[model samples]
Target chain A: MQIKSLNDCNVVQMEEKLDALTSDEVEKALMGLIDNGAKRIVCVFELTEYISSAGLRVLLVVAKKLKKMGGELVLCSLKPLVYKVLDMAGFISIFKIFGSEEEALKSPQEK
Target chain B: MVQGVKISLFGNLILFLVKATALPFVNSLAILSDLGISCVALAISIILYYSIKLADKPADPFHNYGYSKVENVCEAMEGVVLIGIILAISVQAAMNFIHPKHTNMPWVGFICSIISVVINFIGAFYILGLAKKSSSPAIHAEGLHYRLEGFISLAIGISFIISIILRLNGLNKIDAFVDPVATLLVSFMLIFPSFNLARSAFFKLLDASIEESSKMEVIKLLGKYSHKYCDFRDLKSRSAGRKKFVELKLILPEDIPFKEGHALAIALEKDISRNISESEIMIKVEPCGKDCHYIQKNQRCPYL
Candidate 1:
C-alpha cells in the first residue's frame, strides 16, 4: 500500500498491479508532483506487473499535461506484460521508454 | 466411499433396534420420537447407497450432465418424508400432555439412549471425514444427515436421564410430563433443518448461482490480469449439485497470436478454478474488433 512519490530528481518507483482499483491512487500521486511544479519525471516499473486501461488513461492524461507544461514523463524497466499493454494501447509511441532508470535519467540531458 | 455409507446403514439399523427394544420396556414419547427418526434414517441410508453409485457415474451420451442430481432428488424426498414423520409424532406428543402416561423403566431407556448417542456420533464423524475426502455430493449429504441424527439422539438421551432422576426422587407426576415436552421440543427443532434440506435441493435444481463471496474472489483475479485483454463481459456462473460453472468472454488484442491467447485463457481458467472447488470454466477469447475508444477514433491503436 506504501507508494514512495517523487524524489529529488522527480523519479517515482512503482510496484505491483495497477488496475481500476489502484489507478486512482497512482493518478493522485503523479498529479500532486505536477501541481507542486515538479517536472522531467522518471517512472521506474521494475517491480510493476501490468497496467490496465484505467492505468493507461492515467498515464495518457499525465503525459499530456506534462507536454503542455513543457516537461516530460519517462518510463523505464517495464515488465513484458506492462510493455504489451502499453504497446497495444498506442502508448509505446507516446512516451519515452527506456531499458533502465539510468538511461531514462540521461535522456533529458541527451535531448 | 461406499464403505462409509455401508457402515452408517448397518449402524443406524442397530441403533433403531436398540431403541425399539427399550421402547416396549419403557413408556416415553421422547424415546418414541427418536426411534421414529431412526426408521426414517434407515430408509434414507438405503436409498443413498444406490444414489451414490449412480451419482458417481461419468457423463455418457444419454446424460451429458452426469448423475449428480440424484443426490439432490434424494435429499428433497427425504426431507419431505421426515417432516411428515415429525408432524405425526408432534401430534402424539401433544395428546400425551393431557393423558400423561407414567414413564416406566426410565433407567433402561436412559441407558439405551446414551448408547445410541455415542454410536451415532462415532458414525457421524467417520462419515463426515469420508465426505470431505471424497467430495461426493451424495456422501456430503449423508454426513450432514448423520450429524443431525446424532444431535437428536443426544437430546433424547438427556431427556431420558432427566426423567430417570425425577422418577427416582419420587417426582413421578412431573416426570410423566417430561417425555411429551421433550418430544415436542425435539420435533420443532427438526423442522427448520428438514426444510433447509428441501430448499437447498430446489436451489440446486433451479441452477442457482454460487454465493456472492465466491464470485467476488473470481472478480479480484480478473482485475489482476485485466491488462492482458481489453475488456471482459457476460460473466456468468451457476451450480448443479457440487459442481460450479463459470463462463465469460475474454477480449484479447486483435494481433495476439492464437497460441498465446489460448494459453492466457487456460491460465485464467486455472487461476479461477483454484479458488472454487469442483469447478468448470469456459472462456471465449475474441479479438477486440474496434471495441476500444481509440480504435473507434481510428487512432494509432494496435487492435485497430
Candidate 2:
C-alpha cells in the first residue's frame, strides 16, 4: 500500500491481493498514517484483485478508529469480487462506498 | 473490441515465447504449466476478439435482441478452458510428484518468470481498466486470468529460488520436489476464480436479476411517489449484459383519466431512468376499485 495526499483527503492506494498474509502490513501502515494526523482517508481499491476477511477486518478497524477521531474512512473503486464479499458481509451499509475517487472526494463524511 | 483483442493477442504471444524458451532450459514442471496456461490464454483471446466483433453487430430482423449474449458465451468458454488446463496441470504435477526430476538452470527460469510477471501485471492493469469502461465480460475475464497468471509466475519464481537455495545447502532431493509442488499449488489456485467466472456467466445466461443495490435503488425511487398511485405491483427486473429490464404494474383509482395515468407512468419511468440510466422500464397502469373485476371477484387483486 502507498499513501498520498489528494486535496484534503489522504488516499491509500492498495496492491493487487489483500489476504491474511498481507493484511497485517496494511493495517500497520494505515495506523501509522492515522497517527501522523491524517484524518480523512479514502482507500482506493482500483488495483485490488482479491480481499479476504482479514482485509475486511483491517478496514473495519480503520473505520472505527477514524470515526472515534471525528474523521471518516471512505472506500472507492472496488473490484466486483471484492464488492460482492463486502456486500455479503453486510459491510456495504456500514461503510460509504463510491464508484470512483472523484465521487468519494466530493461526498461528505458519513455521520 | 478489435483493438483489445489485438493487444491481448500480442501480449500473450510475447509471454508465451519467453516462458516456452525458459521451459526447455529449466526442466521445471511449474514453468511448463505456466506455459500451458499462456497457450490457453492466447486461444481464448483470439476467440474473444471474434466474439466481441460478432456481439457488436446491431439488431436485425432475425435477431432483434442483438448479439450481446455472445460475450457471455465467450466468457463461459474461457472458464471451461481454464478448468481443462487446471486438470491437465494437476495430473502432470501428480505424476511428477511420484517420480521427481531435478530442474536445471533455475536462475534462467526465475528470471523468465519475473519478466512474465511484470508483463502480465501491466497487461492486466490496462485490460481491467478497459473492461470497466466498456463493461465487456470477455475482457474482464481475460484481465482476471492475466492477473492470476502474474501471481502464478511470481510463485513459480519463488519456488525456483527456494529450490536453488536448497540445492546449495546439499538438499538435492527436496529441491527436486519443489517444481511439482509449486505446479500443484498454482493449479489449485486457478480453481476458485475460474469457477466464479463460469458461475457468474451462467447466471447472466439464465437472465438473473441485477445486483441487490441496483434493485433497491429502483424500489426506493418508486417508493418516493407511492402516494401518487393507489398501489404498485408485480415489480420485476432482470439484467442482460449491460442493460437492465424492469417491468412494473401500477394501480390507479377508476376516476383517474387515461391521460393523467399515462402522464404518471411517463413521469415514473423518467424518475427510474434518472436513477438507473441503463434500464429499460415498462410501467402498466391498471384501473382499481370498481373498474378492476379481479378485485371485485376475490375482494382483492392478486398483485395488490
Model 1 chain A is weakest, by summed lDDT over 10 consecutive residues, at A1-10
In candidate 2, what are the lDDT values of residues A5-81, reduced to their tens digit? Answer: 98878999987888668978998998888778777999999999988755775776676556545567899999999
DockQ of each candidate relative to the true complex: 0.04, 0.02
- What range of 10 consecutive residues in model 1 chain B has the weakest lDDT sum? B295-304
Docking class of 2: incorrect
CA lDDT, candidate 2, residue A61: 62
Which number leads on DockQ? 1
User: Which tens-of-lDDT digit does each residue in B60-113 have in candidate 1?
Assistant: 999987877787787777788888978999999989998988878877987887
Residues B50-107, model 2: lDDT tens digits: 8888887877998787777788888788788888889999999999989999999999
Q: What TM-score against the true fold does each predicted structure earn? A: 0.69, 0.67
The CAPRI class of candidate 1 is: incorrect
